[model samples]
Target: MRQGINPSKTDNRIQLESTHRVILSVYIPNLEEEYFKHAEKVFKLCLESVLYTSHDKTRISIIINGCCKEVEQLIYSYKEDYPLIDQVFYTKENLGKINAIYSIVKSNLEPLVTISDSDVLFLKDWQDETYAVFENFPEAGMVSPVPSSKGYLYSTGSTLYYGLFKGKIRFRDVQDPEGMDNFQKSVGSKLYDPIHLQKYLVISNPKNREAVIGCGHFVGTFRKEVFEKSPTKVCEFRVQGGSEEAYLDDPNDRSGFLRLATLGNFAYHMGNTPAPWMWDKLADLKSFEKSNLQTYSIPSAKPLSKLAVLVGKFLWVNLFYRFRRQFFGFLGMKEKY
Candidate 1:
């Protein structure tokens, strides 16, 4: 009982206008508890910051994972208001953060994709600064706007191995100590060592544009091709444990792509509570003029051979990783903080 031609058969293929896609997985079950009292407000701030600062061609996909009806309605309202919010998926069942991300990323066609936590407050120029890192480092697969002093400890084996022999890596004075301190305060923990806050490892190209080696998982922009190497199976954890390391971190490292961060801090990790300062920051963002969006192509990278990756993990990452600080010191990196 179908129509003769369906009219759809002769239609042209659909084309997406965006070059970059931002994916956010939000899970707010309720507002009754003290821990989640201000969750709605914080989510609103996060979404607004992203909308205000992102490039014109960028698209945002919000996955409402097991949130209350109230939260889902709020997200729907935003979608109706903003054209940039291109996709919205709601699930009554709670899917793990990485699992939710994997669902969207598997079908994503954009050259660049940014996976961000729900509470991150993206600042102005975060997208541009992150893209600049990719432009500077052709081998970089992931770039975070918020730099971590202990970034070098994560999945940065490729950065270390390749940059070391090329003499393109060095220890640089930390550019934003106050920003680092703010991150530590947000998490309510002493995450960075005293020495780490002063100096960190950086990789520079011949053009002298430098980026920090390694990055955290809270928020990061990734090249789409790296996902081709990701595991086909969905993650098991509902949230953070080993899920991120297995799905997000390992794929980029195993693919032999460098993980990096901007030299300057362009975002903040606003935990559950929305402080007065966060409100002030959002107010400031409202007044800032939006920049013209420009698009650039990221070059394709070759994945490492299985044997090469295995040997690297065994020899350098597992065995020599602990001694990196001393080794770098021996190679003219000043140990004095």
Candidate 2:
């Protein structure tokens, strides 16, 4: 005779079962010297975030997109300091972002996966919150922190729409007038006040099953099964030659957002940027809020490098192009590094 299992007890056990696995794939190309500081900051955050949430460090996998001697050295040094980092994978040739991510699908990781840019810093609660979203809504393909209108302005796509006007809500009209203004003030700034009330327009109504299109990669998580089954190639950013721009060409154009939409997957953005004690701007916000508690902390990047960044940002909005060129050059794409 078989013993009957209590229904409530069974339910609790089911919930506690660790059926899902999460791999945090960070695309840090060793080639870009300018973003080294930013990369360091991102690494710090990733490490702490995992340490805070994960009871077993072996579950987390760190994928360094393009590898070089210097990049390897950095990873080695970090490993020496923090032993929790389980696996570090690197490629000899610099594969574009989409390609690098696709490479991980080949590895047969757990059912859940997360791809993040090196710029993202994580607090302890970040992973828990992200995982909660996945556990609660199994259909959700990805979730990201809602872009805060605080220090760094929130933007969408190549257009970079900032705000809306009362009379005319045209895209061109929405501009953050006061330079370097926080997102809070930027929302109120006459040029683009409307976005503040809308909260960056990054997420969809959780109550309603609407398809959320795009989100910044600062912090994003997803299910692994969705990626393994995805026929559409993770297209590389061609103009920029990164992952966001990459997509499937023939049958579908399902990039990150579209792919999730196709599979009835949803996403959410946390809306916390320049987080406390991480950057000068974020630190000021923490002080302003009168919150002394160190809820969480992550690494931070200095604004931009002195040389090409200025020329890229100021010269003619060629920051992307200039940076891409510099990155490829450094990666030995142009010549041997």
Candidate 3:
């Protein structure tokens, strides 16, 4: 089913004028067998989440960055397999996250742009929450589930570490024999739990604002107008050599959050990190506002990984993590999404 926009005569709010459309971009680097294998489950998870939750999955577009012949084949496979997606585009350019974002921002078709990373799992109603955040707080530039910076709430005294997925950020304090079980129990009924030990930091303390500044990995929302007027040059600060997408170059600076906070008070970064537990943790969080959201499970016919592939996955992820940290450290850089 297709829907058309009928803007009212007297409405003046910019966002309201541009409602009912959103664009999601999935940027891929080189096309490789490993890329598809490693990402397939989560990619399907993301696709399924939207299919089950959104009334308008047709609005979603997958933009494959830095395409090659192999990437083209991989994308074709996805298109043949998943029709809910409206279009698949492959770009040969090497624009990083920032430039890609600018491109999305420039597009007149999508009023809202969701930069969805390839390696994240989302709840079925993730977009519902995202849309609600923008609608409820018109000033909000971006909204996402809060990312955990440390382990679970059961971990040592309250603390946080930069996190991307649920299991990825193990809270040392919550590592007791049954700590995961305990933390899961405590975060009950909320949309998301804080990092293992830092639940207090995310949900309870009430940061007195709708949004906070930090790099939100899984997904980030942007008000198109923000990009229309965003500074072309990157902010000068502690971090170096990162995409201009970050408004704040200094990891320690909260200025970006403050800027975003002026727009709305409900933005939260979503998903777990520092590990690969995104699906599990997200599964635990309740969709407090999205009443119609539905969860679906596609039974894994079997573990897709072979022993050699499993070992290789372990090594590759480990090396990726270590190198990611060291590379950022060497450059004194951190992403602020």
lDDT of each: 0.85, 0.38, 0.39
TM-score of 1: 0.94
Q: Could you tally the backbone clashes for each prediction?
A: 0, 15, 34
Model 2 superposed RMSD (Cα): 16.0
Candidate 1: deviation at residue 276, Å? Answer: 1.5
Model 1 residue 336 lDDT score: 45
Query: How much is 337 displaced in model 1, in angstroms?
Result: 8.8
Backbone clashes in model 3: 34
- For candidate 3, lDDT tens digit of each residue in 68-174? 56555765776677555556666676455555444555564554555565544444445555565444334334454433332121111111121221111211221
Tens-digit per-residue lDDT, 220-305, candidate 1: 99999889889888777898778888888889988878889999999999989999999999998888787654566666654455
As a TM-score, model 3 comes out at 0.48
1-337 in candidate 2: lDDT tens per residue? 8698878865664331232333444445554566453555545554554444443322455666655566567766766665455566776656665566566655644544556544443433444455444443343455553332221121121111111100111111112222213322313443334433332222222343322223344445554443533545545452244334232210111211111211111212212232444544333333332122222111121112233223323432444234534643543443211
Task: Provide C-alpha RMSD values for all models, in order.
Answer: 2.0, 16.0, 16.3
Q: After superposition, how far is residue 62 of candidate 2 from its true place, in Å?
A: 2.3
